[model samples]
Target: MERGEKIVKRIDTAKEAKQNPSYFEALVELLFQLADDDFIISFRGSEWLGLAPHIEEDVALSSITQNTMGHASLYYHLLEDLDIGNADKLAHERQAVERRNASYFERKNGEGSYLQEPYYDWALTVVRQFLFETMKKVKLETIINSSYQPLADIANKVLMEQPYHLAHWRMWLKQLLGSTEEAQNKVQFQLEAAWPACADIIGLGPKAFELEKHHLIAGEDYLRKQWLKELEQSLSLPSSLFVDNHPARGRYGEHTADLDQALSTLSEVYNSDQKAVW
Candidate 1:
């Protein structure tokens, strides 16, 4: 299936979970994975605001941030249904240690501050987001077929808005890879940086089998295979064999200081106004 077309066909689903206990647990884990991935990455993306290489690129990238933020919000709302907490509080008030996001998403955007000493790397940003979103699209595609109705339903809705995100990143990848020698080299460097922990993003955590057995979603191994296949066919671009490995697993809640730092930043506002409407 074509990359864009794959996303388009993933838009029909029911928004309710199956009334089985195992299924509910699987649904919860799936939601956490989805929420954490987007929440952490979107935070990183937000840090890039006004720091992109070009003005047009800034506007273009912001759309992705908004989309990821929207995805996070959707998961937060689902958590609310389980009486977890208000969506904003869940997003903004949690401590770093309590966060369930992967470490990679929480990494700093290149180096220096976005406001001053801004030494951002466009290659890293583009490659990381592109690769991450590509895997995310794969996972969401499987979720649309989940037995848990609510998850499948939300997945369907999310799939509708994912094409632009995929297209935007694909364009960046193509242009940079096809650009000047320096640009191609930089992209290659970023891809290498992203390769090691890329597997963490696809992890199904501690409850992988249970989640699958309950029909909450597809199995981890299956999803991983699908993700790789999708990546292979994502764009008619490069064809070099890439190495993928995971030194630290994020699925079981194993994380790094990066996530700790990110949770603190994201929760600052919500933590302060936990009692307020905003």
Candidate 2:
């Protein structure tokens, strides 16, 4: 396949996808990236369980987290269908170095543990979720036409509920950014902090050539361009807010200690009974 050519054959089943080594490898890499990104971020969202600043937000965040986790499960199940591994094990057993989630999503919620004197940063949460959901919407839109039918199907299903999730965070971001000077400063600080680390979030990883050639999804350039266009239309962010530096490329199996801690907590119960069914 050429760089700009559309894939004519639709792979409707895992069996068909696995028939080609190159396609299979690219597909698995893409699935892991999608699945881990959602899985880790949802775990971070789950950390905000009862500490969302208000009762209503508490419930809303929880529901969104559940939905996001369900999205991750769907991706993992597709991986399972490909004979990669058990879905629960894939979610719980992966090490930090094995994870493909952007390191920005794995940063500790704040300076404290959720069970302790939790000092979570709501500004960071709002900014991160808003930015992530925006990029997610762009990526999903690109992949909805994926040559692999099952993956495209999952993208369509996720798109149905993703708008609500994006709206919730966008509302929070807009309100905070437009409120008092202190709130505006907090949001701005997070935006500045997150700007440089976002390169990896919109990236398609080291397998970019294979992913694009196989028509698994559009190229990284297309994703980044569309994401920026969407952000510009939706928010009055400065052009300086966007940078091309990647502090960490989780897609290439690079991560931070924050991911290790998150994994330990996430897999604690499942680790206790490895043989037990989830």
Candidate 3:
């Protein structure tokens, strides 16, 4: 269903990468940024497994979570193809300081655990997932013509499935916001909380110029504008959505204890014995 697939400029190979060090450096950085964001968010989604408001929602959410994690794996494998390391290790064995996901993704899905005292907020999930899925589509579109042909191919493959994810959350956001005052208030609170760090989520981290310099991806400013425009058209956003602070800047290796806690849980099975075959 992918239409008008562009002819991508594939990199010759890591062995033939004769460019200066910064080119590969930017490539790896971008890969980490893409992989880590999806990884953490999917982990968050896993936490919501079987804990959605109802069974049908739970099943649908699980499917979306699996798709997201699958996307992350595709990125990690891309890194592995670069001989960065094993994809499993990159996903599970890294220190929090080495990750590149935005901090908001690692935040708890409201308070309490899924099995006990499951006080997870559906409104927050609706808003956050809607915003993230929209942003992810924008990023993927920018990468569809990526200079790295392998990644461009993956982007095209992923673009086929991404619309469903965006639609699921967008429907949740619209239905909830229009339904009840309480639901709208809850979503509004999430929107306010998300606004401050919204800039970081859309940022290309510290190496934006280098990535664009090598024709790796779209310009960061252009990306930010596109993302913001899409968000404004979908949601009732403030006229001036200024980012005064970052809850955590994962791109710069800056994160919160939330990420630390998340890593421990996500890596529990893998870290039990890194050598064991799963």
In candidate 3, list every pair of residues with a backbone clash. none
List candidate 3 segments past 4 Å from native. Answer: 1-9, 242-244, 276-278
- Candidate 1 C-alpha lDDT tens digits along 26-118: 667778778878988888888888878888888877888988889988998988886667888777776665566666676777667665697
Clashing pairs in 1: 15-150, 16-149, 16-150, 92-267
The TM-score, computed over Cα atoms with residue i paired to residue i, of candidate 1 is: 0.85
**Candidate 1 at residue 97, lDDT?**
52
> Model-by-model lDDT, in order?
0.74, 0.90, 0.84
Best candidate (score: TM-score): 2
Best by lDDT: 2
Q: What's the TM-score of every candidate structure?
A: 0.85, 0.95, 0.93
Tens-digit lDDT track of model 2 for 1-278: 68995546789999999999999999999999999999999999999998999999999999999999999999999999999999998999877888888889999989989888999999999988988999899989978989899999999999999999999998898899789999999988988888887678888788899998988898888887888887775566666543767667898898888999999999889988999876
The predicted structure with the larger lDDT, 1 or 3, is: 3
Ranking by TM-score: 2, 3, 1
lDDT of 3 at 34: 91
Any residue pairs clashing in model 2, and if so which? none
